[model samples]
Target: MITKEDRERVAGWFAGRLPKQWQSAPAEITIDREEITVRLTIPDVDLPKDASDAARAEARVGRAKAFREETRKQRMEIAREAEHRYDAKVSWGLALGDHTELWTHIAAPVMTRLRQPQRMVLDTLVDAGVARSRADALAWCVRLVGQHEDDWLVELREAMASVADVRAKGPATR
Candidate 1:
């Protein structure tokens, strides 16, 4: 928002820059400081579209531009920072130990698919504190291997082992 002083300064400055032809033109200008509104209207349009009219228009635009420089720069910088933060691979998965949230999310559905035997195994581990936190719970449930036996856990371990073995023998011959 511009102050009344700024408004008068700009209006007077603009009026002074107009050509002589608009000297007698009745101009209505209102500057709403809070809204940063600058309204300029020539209540008397009887004057010719000579140098004064063009000059006055130019001056009004110039004043507005000058006053808006800081705002424009701030807006552009904010937009640039937002773009910098967005990436396709935004480290969405666990890094050091952010797996806690992911576990809770997966658990809601996995509990329904478990067989009775698997459920008991999971319950025992969960009770024995094998799953220290959500992350640990998810690790025990999905990735624990040898010595982590309990049919379901064993199957998961074997599945992961198979994947590792496959990866080890890269580009296998047909």
Candidate 2:
């Protein structure tokens, strides 16, 4: 992907960017036209062996490799959990349509699993003019057919916080 002249030109450019303290640093660059990428690498070098006594110094590259694998595993697990929770929330909300369906499907399950305040919050969203209807509240607050989880969650949190502030201003009337 590179000619000898291209390599020399890039290396010259890189050498100028190095610090004064790094006078001995190696300058290397590779350009791949097909990928539209330029990779620059600085070669690692060890100090000269002293008269005291030494064989050769080797890198613990495997340790760095293992550390990368561990970070990857943690990231994958977190992503999987988020996706599963979002899927279940969307499926549950879809089963709820009207009163008859809600009573049979949504009410018992929510009452069993969710805390009182959480259930009340969902109910309040439906009662307010913020949402078009019960299904709209579900679609807006959580994941369902029409909405994205991240954006809808942001809007829902803002609306809920505003509702709390309004309630604090008003009387204790239910």
Candidate 3:
């Protein structure tokens, strides 16, 4: 376990090298086996709050690229120090804003009642080495379908929206 003092010292080392605008941003230090990872997140200010979700995502991509270029030298210095001090592999990645909209976090758990045959198919996928377990196989299958049928998925979502709109209009009175 990393001591509080050590974590603080590591955080301070990187914090001083960060941009003045990001001086107060939080630092997360994690140690695993023989490597230490230090992550510093900065808010992406390029996109307005009112920007569309796609626009925000695109802006985040641009901001990450720009930040890496801007901080390359300082980050390399911190990396060298971390390696020399701890004798461990050190690397870092940046996150934009609160990171709520990252692709992995965007997925919500879906609970569905499946027929016995469907359940068996998921189990078979695990047995065949297609996935680690039934849940993992189900996730893999969903991802496969999503990747191969994005246009169909979009149409399905539009249809669902239309159904909801019609339902919200209420039934015709006799």
Task: Find the candidate with the highest lDDT and give its number.
Answer: 3
Per-residue C-alpha lDDT of model 2 across residues 1-174, encoded as one tens digit per residue: 244454455446445543333232352332333211112122223335462222222222332233335444543453244335322111110010111111111221221355777667667887787676555665566554335466776576567656766766788985
Q: Quick one: ranking by lDDT, best first?
A: 3, 1, 2
C-alpha RMSD between model 2 and the true structure:
26.1
Top model by TM-score, which number? 3
For all candidates, the clash counts are 0, 0, 0
lDDT of each: 0.41, 0.39, 0.68
| TM-score of every model versus the real structure | 0.22, 0.20, 0.51
Looking at model 1, the pairs that clash are none
Candidate 3 ranges beyond 4 A from true positions: 16-24, 100-174
Better of 1 and 2 by lDDT: 1
Return whichever of 1 and 2 wins on TM-score: 1
Better of 1 and 3 by TM-score: 3
For each of the candidates, the C-alpha root-mean-square deviation to the true structure, in angstroms, is 29.0, 26.1, 17.2
Pairs that collide in candidate 2 are none
Error of 1 at 145 (Å): 3.4
